[model samples]
Target: MRNKKQRIAAMCAVLAKNPNKLYSLNYFQEMFSAAKSSISEDAAVIKQAFEDVGIGRIETVAGAHGGIRYIPSMPQAARVLLLKELTEKMTDTSRILPGGYMYIADLFCTPYYVDGMAQIMAEWFVGARADFIVTVETKGIPLAMSVARILNLPLAIARRESKLTDGSVFSINYLSGSSRRLQTMSLSKRMIREGTRALVIDDFIAGGGTVKAICDMLGEFMIEVVGIAAAIVNRYPQKKRISGYRAIFELEELSETKIEISAC
Candidate 1:
């Protein structure tokens, strides 16, 4: 038989893996062969520990549909520290491409970094309770998918070109604010339901043209954009097409000889 401390650790692990899910006390009582009161006490211990660490929180809902659920969180200090580390890594001059853009493919390809970034973004909009995560296809898919997994929500991708694979699609054309050219973005009609809340996520934001275009397209479907998050935000143009977005890193300076980055 597992001891009280062992049981509590196991329960915390289960709750962490399935965040935002409710589990009845009776279910855990049976699972651990303990009384309801004993299980509740164990939960209290775990909750205090979670609060102390600042890594996350455990919410106990009351009443019939109530149970304990784990909510991921990060301290402000920890968030700033992680962003600073990422900024240092991005200072490599070799990452500067032909254009002013810095090569960030390595950051996206690394699962450890992606997971950390996704946690930060998820924490930023946890209160929104978004129904869906929206992003442009390809590059933004990984980051969007990560947030979707954390929130246990569906992901909707806006494609560069409409395809037969997505039957009965909706398309929109808008000018790329940065490139000063027109572009088309598409999404399947069936993928997004009407009047649902969505969180917009992407790997990078430059002039906010793509994100603004996506928000406009979602408007046609009566979807609400609760928030926008990006891994990197370029500092050029000074003003962006979209407002109220969060980013982990902001590009401060970029040149042939050196690159500068800062936490955003």
Candidate 2:
């Protein structure tokens, strides 16, 4: 039989791996071969530890169907630190492309940065009770997928091309904020249900045209956009096409030989 400490550690590992998933006390009691009282005590310890370390949150739901679930959250201090580190790394002038765009494909592909950024973004919309996480195709999918996993929500990707395999698709044309060109994005009719709440996430936002177009498409399905977020927001244009969105980093300045970034 596992000792009390061993049981607690094992339970903590399970909860951490499955964020926002409910686990009944009885389930733990049977798994650990312990009494309900002992299981509760073990959970309490794990909860306290998580709180003290500021890693995340352990919520205890009461009632017959109630149990425990871990909510992935990063403390403000940790969030700021992570954004700061990312800002420093991204400020390297070499990352700036000829089109005045900063290269961040590597960061989105890296699990360390993706997970950190997703956790911070997910925390922002936890209270919004979003039904689905939505993002544009290509770059935003990775970060949006991570956020969906953390929040235990489904992810829907809007594609640049509407494939016939997708069946009936809803398409929209919006001006690209940065490129100043009209672009089309589409989503399958079956991808999301009406009257649902969606949280929009993107890897980068410039004039915010892409995200705004995404929101407009969701609106066609009667899906409400609860929140919008991005890993980086360009400081230029002074005004974005969309409002009330949050970002981890702000691109303060960018040039072929110079780049400046700051944590938002």
Candidate 3:
């Protein structure tokens, strides 16, 4: 016998834990021992409160099979603030590595930064309705995994070395724009389901060769790449092989003990 306020609080907690999961009105009604109309009212109140605080939104489905689901979407202003914080972190001079490469491994290692990246990317690709997330091995795994967790989608990784132990794997070779050399990338055959739409993600894109190679591999499995995302994109001399990808930060300039970056 939960009261009105108690029921509403419970509903918000449940929805927050299970974002994108559909829950029938009857399900909540039985759990709370409340009427359908009462449950709906509780949801409405929670929905408005969530929207007002920039937490997310509650969606109601009308059909017999439909019910309600919570979407963990962030507002534009919050997203912009997050990117601004990241830009300041990227401008640190100590993070610059040899060969003019900026090291951002520290940022990716933190849950706060990675989770914020996931939220921003989820907001960006919400309309795309991507089925799953794809990324190359090593640095991109954190961002890819975070996005997959937030979006409730599976993640597939593309490895640079083909694993014979994992059975038959698909491999492809592409020209690395930075090194100006050919590089081979591979992935497990069973990772991605055929005919599914994929969103590709990467940590940094200098010339987009790695992501381009991942897309080329996806073609073999008939997976439609809906969109691509990166945490950072470097401003380099050569043009990127792949286009239409979004990033959180752009490397505007790099010099000895100097680094410049801005939000993308």
Candidate 4:
């Protein structure tokens, strides 16, 4: 039989690996071959450890169907540190492209960066009462998927164009916030149900055109946008087509020879 220390360590592994998932006390009791009282104590210990370390949140749901769930969260200090590091890296002049755009594809593709970004973004919307996550196609999918996993919510993608594989889709035309050119975005009709709440996640927002288009499309399905989040937002244009969105970093300037970014 495993000792108390062994049982607790095993439980921590399970909980940390499956954040936002619930595990009943009875389930733990059987798994650890311990009594309900002992499992309860073990859970309490784990919760305190997580809180003290500021790694995440361990919540105990009350009720017959209740269980324990680990919610991924970052301490304020850690959030600041991560954002600061990212800002420094992004501001490197070499990252600025000819079109006055900063290249961040590598950052989004890296698991370490994406995971940290997702944790921070997930913490912001943990209480948003969102039924699922939404994002436009291409660059935003990776970050969106990570956030959805952390939130334990489904993800719905809006594509730039409809594909036959998508079957019947709901399409709409909206002006690109930055380019001022009309663009069409579509989603599969069966991707989401009506009257549900959605949280939009995107890799970058400029003029908020893409985000606004997504919001307008979701509106067609009667899905309420609970919140919006992005990895970066351009500081130029001063105003965006959409409002109430949060971003991790703000791009203050982007030129061929220099780049300036700051944490938001």
Number of clashes found in candidate 1 = 0
Tell me model 4's lDDT, rounded to 2 decimals.
0.89
Ranking of all predicted structures according to lDDT, beginning with the best and ending with the worst: 2, 4, 1, 3
Clashes of each: 0, 0, 0, 1
Give the per-residue lDDT of model 1 (tens digit) for 78-185: 777777778878997878888766788888867767777988899888899899999998877888888887777889999999899999998989888788899999
Q: Show model 1 residue runs off by greater than 4 Å.
A: 75-77
Model 1 C-alpha lDDT versus the unseen true structure? 0.87
lDDT agreement with native, every candidate = 0.87, 0.90, 0.86, 0.89
Model 2 segments beyond 4 Å from truth?
A: 75-77
Which should have the higher lDDT, number 3 or number 4?
A: 4
Question: Per-residue CA lDDT of candidate 3, range 6-97, in tens?
Answer: 88878888888777778999999999888999998888998899899888888899999989989888777877888888888889898888
> How accurate locally is residue 144 in candidate 3, as Cα lDDT from 0 to 100?
92
RMSD of each: 1.8, 1.4, 1.8, 1.2
- Quote the lDDT for 3 in model 4: 98
Candidate 3, clashing residue pairs?
none
Off by more than 4 A, model 3: none
Q: Which candidate is the best by TM-score?
A: 4
